[model samples]
Target: MLHVYIEPVPKGQWGPIDGYRIETQDGTRLSGELLRSERLAVSQAKLHGYVPLLATVRIPDKAVAEHWTPADKAPVTV
Candidate 1:
């Protein structure tokens, strides 16, 4: 069983199924989903508590940029 933090995309205009960003305490981030009427269960033997099965997208370190860049494409003259 895995516990993850989910951050939803803004606006909520993506229909019933929207995208979410999932992250862990160790700084691991991924994409996931949240749906209504979803039932999740886990055996105590596996996690010692309840657990939910969810879908998540994988985001690699390279995919994330530490700093923000200019939106417009312009060559920087040093």
Candidate 2:
């Protein structure tokens, strides 16, 4: 299970104001044109077999990264 960290795009960041950005715990970033909202970004991560986590605050791009053990990649069932 890949743990993905998600947070909103900062006020003056590169992405849209209402957009969300996602990245893995290991600092691997994921990009998408449709990540216009937090829910959409989480959904996208789920679709990629990643477990999404919401961040309380914005995380710096150059922050130290840590790897996590892989878990089940089972598809989410409605």
Give the candidate number with the greatest TM-score: 2
Those runs of model 1 whose alpha carbons end farther than 4 Å from true positions after fitting are: 9-19, 32-78
Report the C-alpha lDDT of model 2 over 1-78, residue by residue, as the tens digit: 757876566633565356666776565678655367666777888888888766443444425333221223323212
Q: For candidate 2, give the lDDT of residue 17.
A: 58
TM-scores, each model vs. reference: 0.25, 0.58
Q: Please, what are the lDDT tens digits per residue for candidate 1 over residues 1-78?
A: 454433333323444434344444364553334322212111211233322222232322323343212212222211
Q: Show where candidate 2 strays beyond 4 Å.
A: 11-16, 58-78
- lDDT for 5 (candidate 1): 36
| Candidate 1 whole-model C-alpha lDDT, 0 to 1 | 0.31
**Candidate 2 weakest lDDT stretch, 10 residues:** 68-77
User: Clash number for every model?
Assistant: 1, 2
